[model samples]
Target: MERRIISAGFVQDALAALTRRGLDPAPALAAAGIASGNERVSNLQYGRMWLAITAMIEDEFFGLAARPMRPGSFNLLCQAVLHARTLEHALRRALSFLRVVLDDPAGELLQKDGLAEIVLTDRDRPRLAFAYRAYWLILMGVMCWLVGRRIPLMRVDFACAAPENRSDYHQFFGAPVHFDQPRSRLVFAAHYLSLTPIRSEKALQGFLRAAPANILIRYRHDQGLSARLRARLRATPPEDWPTLDRLAADLRLSPATLRRRLRAEGQSLSAIRDEIRQAQARIMLAEGRLKVAEIAARLGYAEPSAFHRAFLKWTGTSPAAYRTDKQG
Candidate 1:
């Protein structure tokens, strides 16, 4: 599967946060392998820029909040919420944590009529849309990873003016983004709050090691070459996953063009295939109805031992142990 490349406007907006502070973004952008400002960027490059920016500014929130969010702020927040029994517990803790750290934009979790909303109340000036976007990314990113699935957003409302890349923001959030609204808020189903978090401690540790880069990947839209390939692969069984040539033909592109596009998106067919298999295996393990060997066979592993090692490589734990942990 190909990772979607973001618009040039996003690159500019992200870096603008630094430039507005009178800090040069050149060093960070260069460190992330970005050049001309108008060029589109891969998620990897953009994520790298985020790390460099945070490290340089010593603020994960781009110094938008009155109190600078120190380097380890997000890490501590994740660790604090890791043990929560359900999504609602985790979110409330997250909101509370933000309240203690940031002076403006108090966060509240409210539910009524089977819907949940995360509202950010700005005490004085409304925050930049990009800043609000980052906050949502952090919360929704964690929410999706914990639930082991994407929690669909109903709509995102922003009090700030829409930027030139409004459509890009819409795609990034995978939901409609309304600008110049009454307040900044995120809406979703209240029932999602009751679902238990599916990530294990070990898995979260591995996730934190990658940090914002991997976290950002969890929440982008199904766009571009990777999106098309992902749709095709998910529609077929593991055993029926097509070869590159076959997939290229199906996509109506020459094999060479397919290869080039995948490269640009920082993706490979084999890696995408592996990702699909890993996802299917994880879902099966979570359901707890299938035997390990049966699940292995369904995922195209002829031998259960091969499946065990593969699962270990993907999740940092053996299949049986992972299943046991999830059950407990």
Candidate 2:
């Protein structure tokens, strides 16, 4: 099994921090022999770029004479987090902004059943070796400090067996963090979503717009089939829309096999087709040049009425109403 690496977003975040501390990041990048003109700097797919930046920070910025800067680095991140309006908003911002401080490909924060669950997807990796757990701990601690009250954890679930540092985990989270579960997650009450952010949206936007190109490419991977299907829909004409069997064949699987695989992934051929149709319909409606009948024929509908019905199902309104709303 291959080891997935940190994302370029993570590297850019670290560089941003170093810059905040009045340090020139160009020297660090130069030390890593990463050329200024390298497109990878702008591309998000270069996960190793983050690893290189981490090495530089540990070696040059902190140095052997001092302890690792993990604690201090985390402190700065937590300071940013406390500025958010609500804990829910803060978590979303943290997910977007704090990629540099840690990298865990198998982790995600989700809301379900009126609670927030920080889900960890990886089970085979060493628990202590995971960077995101440390980040989460610091975040929880800082959030408590900012709110002037402790947030009780509803439950904790871990994928691995008990670690040697079990006492540390218990003390830090102040919850019964369990182990040997199918998946790891931190469950918390949902009401924390209403807190106002301490930081300005303009400041956050600046960071987002200035995000390194490499980071964008890395994050794009998570957009999943929606992106790929969209690209295909855009590039192909309606007349050339591939049949399910043809698409399955192109993907190197039998039609039945493809349906089974999609089922496992919690998707379906009909859903994908409907999604493509709805997207194309919106684009056509927005363009305003195509007649409704022409659009229906172009979309492979047998009749304009059939197309109207599908459009109504897709948007809860008639196609004419949708176009009128867009014009309005």
Candidate 3:
């Protein structure tokens, strides 16, 4: 997968810790070969800057919390949870270690009603979004690497008001984000907690070597979850798409369980099928080769007229007009 580029504002937030300590971030920025005013930076560049800042302050957390998270503290956390059999056990171990090391913003892992929540308890001082993000990235990043898949977030709530670059939350988490929420928490399907961790000790070493950079950007693979689900839909023609129950049974899950999991990830079976058809229609139209009627039949439409209506609904233009516009 292509690396995700982060906005300059994210860097500014990370540098806030230096500013808090009355320390200049110039040297750290220089170490990372980044400018103070650059509009964006690659994941690697941001990770470099993060390391430089941590070394300078002797705190992995940038001194945002009541106590400084000493260097190698995160490494120990990774080691502590390395042998955990499932995501649930790993998270339990991880949060326990964090509470002992960091004084403020206690973290809790709660699961109920088929959903799991990682809630951060607020203390004396108001928490910055950076602190919230750091805690999340640590847990989330580790969890993804542990399960060998990106656990899609349902929603992320922050206690602090929206920051200047709050949109980055959507780009990073790929979910609806709300600011100034009652408490800061990350939510996802509880079933994911039962997934067995698949990474090895050597893999953990390599992962920590890259640290938050690799964690910041997910390296895509045939890992698990919806990627496999989407791939299954994409492989079969629209007319041959299996029923929900069949698909669920094929994946060894109950139909209701499958539906609930997809819903938690903010997706639906019908919606995914529509997206696939839409994408195929656009590509075929752009090619300017296939007849409109032929394309409609291949997409499982009973008549060209029905396809026309659906096309208009999807793109606000007739298929012929869409083709003509693309051709021109």
| 249-268 per-residue lDDT for model 3 (tens digits) | 99899999998876644456
Every candidate's lDDT: 0.79, 0.54, 0.79
Clashing residue pairs for model 3:
none
What TM-score fits each model?
0.67, 0.39, 0.68
Q: On TM-score, who's better, 1 or 2?
A: 1
* Candidate 1 residue-wise lDDT, 112-191, digit = tens: 54458999989777888888888888877777777665565667999888886357787777556899998999886565
* Cα error of candidate 1 at position 257, Å: 26
Q: What's the number of clashes in each of the models? A: 1, 18, 0
Residue 189 of candidate 1: its Cα lDDT? 55
Ranking according to TM-score, highest score first:
3, 1, 2
lDDT minimum window of 10 residues, candidate 2: 59-68
